[model samples]
Every structure is written in C-alpha cells, then in structure tokens.
Target: MRILIVTNYYEPEEGAAAVIITRLARYLARQGHQVTVLTSAPNYPHGRIHDRYRGRFSLSETRNGVRIISTWLWATPSPRISRKFLSQITFMLTAALRGLTLPRPDVMLVEAAPIFTNLAGVFLSFVKRVPYVLDVHDLWPDHMLTVGAMTERHPAYRAARWLVDHTYRRAAQIIALTPYLEQVIRGYIPGMDKVRTVYSGVDLERFRPGLDDAAFRAKHALGNARIVAYIGTLGTAYDCLTMLETAFHLRDRRDILFVIMGTGTQQQVVRDRLAQGDLPNVRWIEWVKYTEIPQAWAATSIAFWALFNHPLHRGAVGTKMYEALASGVPIAVALEGVVADILRESGAGVSVPFGSVDALSAAIRRLLDDPAYYARCSQNARAYAEQHFDAEKAAQTYEAALLKAA
Candidate 1:
C-alpha cells in the first residue's frame, strides 16, 4: 500500500503527533508499504524553524524507510492566536500542493491538529479520489478554545469546522486516539459509522528498566536525589505547574526532586516559575534525545504524567504514560479523566484528581513513603507496559486501521 501522511509535526520536531507518525511510518514501511510523509521543516512547540532547515521552502529526505517531504509553514516565536491559525493554513496548502503531484496514494492518512492537514484530506478524498482517513488528534477549534488558544465562536472556529466537517463527511474512514474526541466529532458531523479508536502505543521494549545507564545518569548528576518527572510538551494543555506545586509542597523532603524534560510554548513561563522561587529540588531539562531516555529513567524515581484537566484529556493518550510504566517507575498522574480509569483498572499508578494540590501532594507522598504499595505500582507499571503499550501493538493497530479502511 502507498500511504501519504500529512501532519504539522514530524521528525526533528517533537510532540505527540511527531512521535506517533514517525513510529507508524517506520513500522508500516518495514511491513512492505510505501509511506510518504508530507510535513513542514521541523518547527514545533518552540515555534522556531530548525537551524538546518531554516529559510528553505521544502526539502525531501528519507528517514529509515519513509519518504519525508518537508515544506514551508508559519514559524512563530510564541504561541499567539493569529500565528497558530496561520501556521496551520500554511501547512495545509504547501503539503496538499506537494502531494498532488506525487503518485496516487492507496490511502491518505491526514492528521487533524493543524486542521489544515484535513484540507489536504478533503482534497484527496474528492480530487485524487483516494480513501482518506482523518486521524482526529484533537477536536480542533474546541481544543484550541479549551487551551485558550482561540475562541469558541470565532470565525476561524467556523472555518476549521467547515473543513473538518467536509473531510468527516467525505473521508472513507476516521481514527481518534480517545473516545472523547470521537464523541465530539459525532456531535458535530452526525454520521459516525466510519470512526474507530486506537490508543497510541509505546515501544515498551525500548522503554524499560534494563536500559538504564549509570554513566549517563552520572553525567547529568541524576545520582543526587529521588526524581519525579514531567516529560513532554509544556503547552497550555499540560498542567506542569501543578507538578511544580507538588514539588514545592514537599520542599521539606529535600531528597525528592522534580525534573521537567521536553520543550513547548509555555517554556518561558516555566522558567519564570523556576526563577521566581528557590526550589533547588526542581531541575528544568530542555530537550533530551529519545535514545537517551534511559538516562532519564536512571535518574528518576517517579514519573508524573501531568496534563491540564479538560474534557479533551479524557480520551487522549500520550506515550509518556506508557514510557513511565516501561521504565519500571511508578506513575503519578494528576490530571483527572479517562487516564484515571485506566490507571485504576491496571493498578499501575495512583491518581490525584485534577486541580487539587492537596491530592497531588498526598499521592506523591504515598508512593514515596510506602514500600509495598510503591513496589506493587512499579511492578504493575512494567507489566502494563509490556502487555499493553508496546510499539508492536501500535504498529499492528495502525496497520489494521488502514486495512479496515480499505
């Protein structure tokens, strides 16, 4: 099968979509499918074009086996309402125009975040006459509004709705990471027979306790304390400040440390919070290579999957959750939603209801102080990672989605 994946986030860029697409493309390519990724020069959460691809219109390259076509898109220094919408528009146009000339794809897998990517899917469904699938990463305007990135009744919302509705109406099939997003789509678009849910998969084999390296930890000085980490985007949707508050609340436990790793739009604000007080227990790690994640694991005692409590978060799944489990470290997730349900079902971690500083602190303390419960959580974490979150499962689910769409 020849597949074309259009998304704003991809390799050299970092985010949930980037990781998801990269893994899927590689996995599919290995299975003898031809994959073409139509994306922009790597500029993401930081809002700056990569130093290497700067000032270029588009560049085509191959990573692993997938053909990557990088194109022009809006680059912003910060996440402003006007700039984000423009960026999505830029991506949709350039990617669509580029994919038009390429060989006819058997399936068009368009990621809906930029919302413009769906424009390409909208065209491919009607123009190229390919069976396009819109992977609903978020509910678009609704999510943007939730994050305060945009207004609910704004013109852009209506425009995005129109484009998405067109694709939803036209596409052969639909995939959503969470049920919450699926319901959101059905509410607006009506017909829902084509939609399906496939939670994101983690490479449990790569993300496990055995990978921990002492040399890497010593280099980063990770040897000094018990680390509780929040890894992934610092975007508005992630309530990492709450993790900081948890750290501050336990300041008396000097042995406990909070390590924040990853990049995003809210980085400056995070820095401000770090500088405002004297919490030496906190360490802000910029971006770390995925290959070096074992270092992160070696250094941390607990992993915090902190997300902003929102309706969208209920069905959302990110790799960080499984990664924490794979590392044999207990998870402390404070953002209430579907995640809590999964955690409770698996007994993999403790859940602190969202926005409750006291609950978050108590959960952290419970994991830290109780040996048997903490060990059970840790063991359950690893067991869950192996049983449910491996990349093999992810690849299989992705393959099934395409085959089913066909």
Candidate 2:
C-alpha cells in the first residue's frame, strides 16, 4: 500500500501530533507500505521555522524509510486566532500545490487541525482522485470555541463550520482519537460507519518505567524531593494556572517539589504568576527536546495532567496521558472524562475537579505520603500501558483503517 499523510506537524517539531505522526509514518513504512508525509517545514510549539530549513520553499528528504516533503508556511508564536488561521491557510495552499506533483497514493490520511491543513487533502482528493481519510484531532470551530478562540455568533466560526462539515461529508473515513469523539461525530453525520477510533499510543521502549533518573534529578537540582510535574504544552486548553496555584498552596512542603516543564501560548500565565511572588518549592523548566521527555518523567513521582473543565474536553485525551502511564508514573488528572475514567479503571491515579487548588494539592499529598498507594498506582500504570497503549498496536489498527479506506 502506498500511503500519504498530510499534516501541519511532523518530526523535529515539538508536540504530540509531530511525535505521534512520525511514529505512525515510520511504522507503516517498516510494514512494507510506501509512506510519504506532506508537511510544513519544522515550526511548532515555538512557531518559527527551524534554522536548517530556513529559506527553502520546499525540501524533500527520506528518513527511516519514510519520504518527507516539507513546504513553507507563515509560522507565528502568537495565540491570536487570526494569526494562526493565516498560518494554516498558507500551509494548506502550499501543501496542496506541492502534493499535486507527487505520485498519488492508494489512500491519503489528513490531519484535521490547526483548522485548515486538511483543505490540502481535500484539494488533492479532488485533483488527484484519491480517497482521503480525515483524522479528526479536534472538533474544529467547536474546539476553538471551547478554548475561547471565538464565539458561535462570529462569521469566522460559521465559515469554519461549513468548511469542516463539507470535509467530513467528503471523507472516505474519519479517524477519531477517542471513542467519545467518534460518538460525537456520529451524532451529527448520518452515515457513521466511516468513523473509527484509533489512539495515538505511546512507544513503550521510549517511555517505560525505571530509567536511571539520578543524573536528571541532580542536573535539575531536584534533590530527592518528591516531584509533582505538569509536563507538556502549556496551552490554553489546559488549566496551567491552577497547577501553579496548587504549587503555591503547597509551597511550604519542602519534601514535595512542583515542576512545570514545556512551553506554549499559555506560558505567559506562568510568567505572570511567578512575577507576582516567590515560589521556592516550584521549579520551572522552559522546554526540553523530545528525546529528554522520558528522563523528565523518570524524575517525576507524580504527574499532573490538567485540562480545562469543559464539555468538549471530555472527548479529548492528550498523548501525554499515555506517556505518563507508559512511564509507570501515577497521574493527578484535573479532568473528569474519558481520560479520568481510564485512570480510575486502571487504578493508575487519582482524578480531581479542575481548578481546585485544595483538591489538587491534597491529591498530590496523598500520592506522596502514602507509599503503598503510590506503589500500587505505579504498578497499575505500567500494567495498563502494556495492555492497551502500545504504539505498534495503534499503528496496525490505523493501517487496517487506511487499507479499508483505500
């Protein structure tokens, strides 16, 4: 099978989509399928093109058996909707034009996010007569609305809805990251048989438990303190402010240290809070390369997955959740949805109400003080990952869906 994946994010870009998609593309290529990825030049979380690919219009390279074609896009670090829309639109046009010159695949998988990137796939499907699958990462304008990017009454919201709906109807298959998302899609679209749920699971070898963390801890001056970490993008969808506040609430606890690792648009919130006062027990690490993520997890005693309390988020599960479990680290999730249910079912961690400083602080304290409970959750975390979150298993499921669509 010849597979083409169109996405705004890819390898060398720091984010869940980039890491997961790269893993999937490489896995398909290894499985005897010809895989090619059509993406914008490396620019993500930071939103500036990488130095290596700086002035190029497009560059084609092959890595680990997968062909990668990266095109130019207007990248920005701004959190404003209009700025991001412009970036997505530019990438959509460039990717579509670039994709036309390549050999058409048996089937193409398009990532539907940053909102307009999937338009490239839609354009190619029409021009090249290739069936395309829409990988619905988020529910578009609705997700934008959930994150306060825009209002339902806005003209842009209406326009996005129309475009998104058109793509949904035209797609040969729709891949939802969660079963809840699949149900949500089925509610609106008539012929629901096309929708399927395929998680972007974690690579156990890269994320598994018990790595030597002495160097990591020593380098960071973590110093034997129980680390309660919030690792990953500090985006608007997350309640990072609450996590910081929780750290402040427990600032007096010298044995437990709070670490916020990763950077995003909402990073200013952290800066503002830090500027207001001193938080001796809190350590903030701006960012780290993807390869160092597991070591950060290894140094963690408890992981905090904080999502905003919104109805839309119930259908969402960040890839970090799987990574945390794979690392055999117990999570303190400030969410009550599919992710929270999975945590409860696996006995891997505790879920608290979002934005509650007391509840979050208490959860961390319990996990830290009760060694037996902590040990149990730690064991359960690895067990759950082994049973369900293998990256290879997810790629196989994704491959089957792509083959069926073709």
* lDDT tens digits, residue span 1-406, model 2: 9999999989988688899899899999999999999999998877889998889989999999999999999989897878888888899989988999999799999988866787788888888888888998788878878877789899988998888888888898898999888888887676668898888889999998989888888878889888888888887788877888888888888888889988887888888888877788888899877878999899898999677888888788887889899999999877788998998999999988877778888998899889999999999999999999898998888888899889
Mind giving the per-residue lDDT tens digits that candidate 1 earns over 213-300? 6776676676768888887777677776777788888889977878889877778778888987777788888888767776677567
Error of 2 at 105 (Å): 1.2
Cα-based TM-score, every candidate: 0.94, 0.97
Give the range where candidate 1 is weakest over 10 consecutive residues by summed lDDT. Answer: 117-126
lDDT, residue 370, candidate 1: 95
User: Candidate 2: misplaced stretches above 4 Å?
Assistant: none
Candidate of highest lDDT: 2
